[model samples]
Target: MYSIFGVAWFSDPRKLFALVRQRLNLGGVFVFSQPPGSLGAYGLQGMYKGGFAGPAMYTYRFSYTHAMWRSLLLSAGLRRSRDLLHEAPKPDHIGTSDCPSRVPE
Candidate 1:
């Protein structure tokens, strides 16, 4: 195969890590997507602006910045590759709320 590697829901990447541990083959690379930044005021601010962050909000969305993901991957025997962070775009504006921020991503 060209690449036995794969990407699972890094959303809860640790889950994927476990799967990868059982499924991945030699030379396989597991790629996953992630959001950047830590969960906190800034992160919460961004979320408030971005809109629709869902109840499963994270402190950070950066690429694989999760210690859990790292631990799971390592525990499952997957090598850590470069994390990729993707910032969801903020809403153009809020729907007439004085929240000072727009929709969350």
Candidate 2:
């Protein structure tokens, strides 16, 4: 499955990663992109206020270091197949991971 600029919206990344791992078929991959922690607070509050003419809303947008991403993926029974963070367009970091054939116990 591919998630572009969407993973950060997950408040609970561990649960999200586990769900993705469980749904993948053998040889499947999970690819996603989001702003890295280095980029600092990137969230929807500005958009909500500007577009909807509403007060700033509370939302979850999680960012992590490269090492943190690796650990999270491993715990969810996935392995980092490739890291396209360097090649990602400005301000976004892309990560690619391969799912194991079976979920870890």
Cα RMSD (angstroms) for every candidate in the order listed: 13.3, 5.5
Model 2, 8-54: lDDT tens per residue? Answer: 34546688888888898767777776645535543223223235557
TM-score of each: 0.41, 0.66
Off by over 4 Å in 1: 1-12, 37-64, 85-105
Candidate 1 all-Cα RMSD? 13.3
Tell me how far the alpha carbon of residue 67 in candidate 2 is from the true structure, in angstroms, after superposition. 0.7
lDDT (tens digit, per residue) of candidate 1 on 77-103: 676654443333566421210101111
Candidate-wise lDDT, in order: 0.40, 0.61
Top candidate on lDDT is: 2
Give the Å shift of residue 57 in candidate 1.
Answer: 15
Q: Candidate 2, overall lDDT? A: 0.61
For candidate 2, the C-alpha RMSD (Å) to the true structure equals 5.5
